[model samples]
Target chain A: MNREHDREIVRYRAPTRINHWIVAISFVLAALSGLALFHPALFPLASLFGGGPWTRILHPFIGVVMVVAFVLLAARMWRDNRIDARDRAWLRNVGDVIHNREENLPEVGRFNGGQKLLFWVLVTCVLVLLLSGLVIWRAYFSQWFPIGAIRLSAVAHALFGLILVCSIIVHIYAAIWVKGSLRAMTEGKVSYGWAWRHHRAWFREVVSARRRAD
Target chain B: MALQSLDIVRRSATTTPAPQARGAHSGQVAKLIDVTKCIGCKACQVACMEWNDLRDEVGHCSGHFDNPPDLGGQSWTIMKFAEHEHADGSLEWLIRKDGCMHCADPGCLKACPSPGAIVQYANGIVDFHEENCIGCGYCVTGCPFDVPRISKHDRKAYKCTLCSDRVAVGQEPACVKTCPTGAIVFGSKEDMHEHAAERIEDLKSRGYANAGLYDPAGVGGTHVMYVLHHADQPELYSGLPKNPVISPFVSLWKGAAKPLGLLAIAATAFAGFLHYIGIGPNRTDEHDEREAEREAQRLRAEEHP
Candidate 1:
């Protein structure tokens, strides 16, 4: 029988875990508010955020919060996301992914190719949204900026919104498509078998800890 | 002599054979509407609703015959009326028909996660397949024009099919058919462009100097073009984007992240391959194991010595 004292090593500290949840929750809020502002028919969805005017008022603020939270998360995990030479070779054989032949593919450590790409894409999108949103924000910055700048910001905001939506769609699909991925975010843990199969390097680290304790 | 030579070079450059029209290869019939001529009767809206068999019960039917405030499950097309007072004290009305622009670089097509749910038909029309849609609403967010609408009942995204079934059989869209003012023209984009230019010139000669065609070279140029009479601003009219662009941030993200992601995967795989070939750096765990073995051997040697 497993003893209470014989737990595995911590993969993420409590602060790191909490920061992740903040970004995740804020992202959902921003996405929902964004969709409401995107169309008139969807304007009714603003009621979810207290109504149309409130939704509009709160959208940029929510975006700001999301950006701040994501920036913190990014700083903490930036090193893990850096691309290495081995990653290039893994990409060349990405076709194996389409066939569910990852067994023959490389064993990744903490984060895989898909996760790293998502991390960086989210970073770029959030940055663009925040900057452009500031430039075009009528309630706040329109008085301070030139007309041309405001116009350009409006265009940029729309464009970034489109890109972020697309990327998030792909991100969500990948999470759902891969069976055990959502559990990592939701429960903050994955099953032993799932970790061993998908992230074998990390799994080995955990196993070695067990042996040392024994 | 220098100015003359420059003029000659410019003339030659301008006269060079223009590249064959891009949309021509797609076999899609493009539609361009001259909004300057549209009287905003909304006959096209009625015709679209009837043709598509959309109902009035879905808050789509605006009283007084406007029958739809915006694009929704029951409405494929809408006519927005923008009225402004001219400097001369007379009121001018600019009417625009709102629907899918059927852009060459369709964001909806790019954004859809479910394959085959949203597709660009060979004819250049963006088509939707209900069977393949997971109803995730990605297309709703992807569209720059805010064209697609999702139904709460089934969660499926819907939008103008650009009358694909009718166009396939070589017929005009229902709205174009019902337009009495010849404002909504249905023809090749090239022909529509020429017609719109002539109409704009005619309106200008007749004293509407503000009259011009609205076709910005963005979204790779929308197939639907508009000619507006009000010279003030196009944004006052509904369904007109003040500024539209494929966000550079998206381009940068796609450019940088996609390659880096592939690289990360490749590196991980190469590490695995190295392990297989026995040339890799000792696996981290294996290195620890080797270190432990070395310490044990040293302890034995010390005892023997």
Candidate 2:
């Protein structure tokens, strides 16, 4: 293991890490199948799921898995991801944060404003996708609805799906860009130096809470 | 079956272009329905059911003359009745045959994700190959005319094929063969247009000044045309859209939005890559490590001192 791992504090627990990966992997599968169905150009991607028919058959099932995993993951992280005055300040200084001018920005907690906003965006998109998907799910529920409503739901499903995909792209990028964030999810720990530089407020809290427990 | 293969002009989710080498002698066919002459006899509905061998569950009359209520996997055709009152205290019973329009620009074909599930013939008939259907129902949302029904039994989409099977053998559709009145006509689209014009003229002569044909240009015209007495007000005939086109939302979701969404995702990754290249990983250096160590040391000292 790297020396950084030796000097690390727990960021995500084992359950949270496992829950996050389940959501992430499910999202990737769902997005790929959804893209294959969305356009002819990407139809070849369906081959990864056995073929077009199988892709269609599996996409909604994968979505259900993703949504369930996400709910569990979100329930745990929701408190940390809540936006506050400090998060607002962090958002205002996003340019500095992006450029690694950490001293010029607010002290970030477990999640900064961008991450909090992304969390809520994902929640909203997933909910809309589930609702709209049911209405347009021809095999089961579509006959019960008016055609006009199904048409609207189709459009809404596509739009929300696209938004969720784009948001996840950014989420993945942020994890990779922030240096030690991947380890927090993968190994459930982050170096003290990493915690101090990126999430100083969270680092302080963790240290104080440890002292109190001692 | 081989001849049927030669006629397909478009196939949904198909990569290569469909066969287009057929000679110019094959005329495009059409169905003409004269709303002015219709008496809502429901014979066409009966003929369609008989020809297609579909027996939908007998449904109760749900406060409307339209039986079997709405289109379904089995019920390909229905007669819609609208009671309209003219400004001068005259009540008119307007009856329209509602089914697939067989559009030149079929939204169902455009939106369908499964290959060979929905196909358009060169003769202007859109047909569904049920065996290839995945039953995702994108076609249902894509249809501007609100056609296409997914069966509860097999979960495959169904719609008016314009009797492509019958047409393949050079016979008129069963509905046209069975209509008591000459309200339903089947011929070459060119011939049907001419017939519709004559019918419109007769309707105009009968004190219907606004009589015209309903072949909406918004869907790039349809194989099925209707000559209506109140043609100017199509919505009066049981909410037939006065100006029907594929929904703009559907268009955006299926059209430019696809490429743009892919581009947005790609651009985001590219931006992230560029940011990483420019700034490198924001790894904590020796100074950061020292500072964190010092802070921890201070916290420990304060706790124990």
> Scored by CA lDDT, what does every candidate get?
0.64, 0.86
Residue A122's lDDT within candidate 1 is 81
Q: What is the C-alpha RMSD of each candidate to the true structure, in Å?
A: 15.3, 3.0
Error of 2 at A93 (Å): 3.5
Question: What tens-digit string does per-residue lDDT give for candidate 2 at B1-305?
Answer: 45446757899988688776663266889999998778889999999999999899998989979998899999999899889998999999999999999999999998888878899988898999988887787887888888888887877889998898898789998889888998999999899999988888887888899999999999999998898898899999888878889888788877887778878888988988999999876778878878987887787687678
- Model 2: residues with Cα > 4 Å off, grouped in runs: A1-6, A50-54, A143-146, A210-214, B1-4, B23-26, B63-65, B85-91
Best model per DockQ: 2
User: What's the DockQ of model 2?
Assistant: 0.61
User: Interface RMSD computed for candidate 1 is what?
Assistant: 14.4
Provide chain B's TM-score, model 2.
0.92
Clash count list over all predictions: 13, 0
TM-score for each candidate, following the candidate numbering: 0.52, 0.91
- How well is each residue in B1-305 modelled by candidate 1, as lDDT tens digits? 42111111111001132232233353446777877667788888788888888765556444543446767767778877767676899786766788888777776665553434665654557767665564544455456677877665555678888787787667888888888988888877777778888988999899877878776667877767678765347786764885565445433332343345435444655544544354322122434334434543454466556
